[model samples]
Target: MYAIIQKFHSGWAYIALLVLVIAVVNAILGMASKKEFTAKDRKIALFGLIVTHIQLLIGLVLYFVSPLGLASLGQMSDKSLRLTSLEHPFVVIIAIILITIGWSKHKKLTTDESKFKTFSIFYGLGLVLILSRLPWSLWF
Candidate 1:
């Protein structure tokens, strides 16, 4: 069960990150071009939002079940353990929160520029944060 969930989480990370990058790039492009926010743009962002949320749910379950997750919390002195146990999960959660905020805030925005700007700032920050804290050693 642990191995299965771990593999799924690792595999899903790619999809989540890819979608997020696409969303961020789309928003940045839209903002730069001053393009009107259309249904297609909203759907792109929404897909990113949904995918990340699903990844978060899977990660949460893995965190509780994997030995390297919550189980290794007490071994914070070990850098690798520290990352899987605390840093990775915590930072990822924060990133997801920022993404969610971007989604919610965009809904309340009136201008296409404001919506694109909000997504660019929030989702871009979220992507950066997630990338920064990733267990790169494990991935490779």
Candidate 2:
């Protein structure tokens, strides 16, 4: 069960990251070109949100079940164990919250530019945070 969940988490990370990157790039382009926020644009953002949320759920479950996750929390002196057990999960959760907030804020905005800007800043920041803390050795 742990291996299955771990593999799912690893595989899903690729899709989640890719969708997030696409959404961020799309928002940046929209903001730069001063384009109206169409349904397609909204869909792109929504897809990104959905994938990320799914990834988060999977990650949460994995954290509880995997030995390298919560089980290794006390091994703080070991950099790799500390990262997988604590820092990675914590940072990813914060990033997801930021992405969620960006999505919510975009909905309340009245202007196309405001929506694009909101997504750009929030999603972009979230992406950066995720990238910074990702366990590259494990993933690769």
Candidate 3:
């Protein structure tokens, strides 16, 4: 169960990150070009939100079940264990929150530029945070 969940979490991250990157890049492009935010743009961002949320759910389950997750929380002397047990999950949660905020805030916005700007800033920050804490060693 732990191995399956861990694998799923690892695999789903690629899709989640890809969608998020697309959303951020699209938002940035829209803002720069002063393009009107259309239904397509909204859908793109929505897809990003949905994918990330799914990834987060998988990650949460893995965090509880995996030996390297909650079980290793007190073993912070080892950098790899510290990342999986503490830093990775912590930062990823915050990143997800930022992404969620960007989604919510964009809906309340009236101007297209404002919507794009909000997504660019928030999603971009979330992406950065997630990337920074990712277990690169385990990935490769």
lDDT of 3 by residue, 1-140 (tens): 88889888889999999999999999999999999999999999999999999999998899999899999999999999999999999999999999999999999999999999999999999999999999999999
In model 3, what are the clashing residue pairs, if there are any?
none
What is the RMSD, in Å, between candidate 1 and the native fold over all Cα?
0.5
* Error of model 2, residue 55, in angstroms: 0.4
Residue-level lDDT for 78 in candidate 1: 99
> What would the per-residue lDDT of candidate 1 be over residues 17-66, giving only the tens digit for each residue?
99999999999999999999999999999999999999999999999999
Q: List the residue pairs that clash in candidate 1.
A: none
Poorest lDDT segment (10 consecutive residues) of candidate 2: 131-140
Task: For candidate 2, give the lDDT of residue 98.
Answer: 96
User: In model 2, which regions exceed 4 Å deviation?
Assistant: none
Which lDDT tens digits does candidate 2 get at residues 1-140? 99999999999999999999999999999999999999999999999999999999999999999999988999999999999998999999999999999999998999999999999999999999999999999866
TM-score on alpha carbons, each prediction: 0.99, 0.99, 0.98
In model 3, the worst 10-residue window by lDDT is 1-10
The CA-based lDDT of model 2 is what?
0.96
Per-prediction CA RMSD (Å): 0.5, 0.5, 0.6
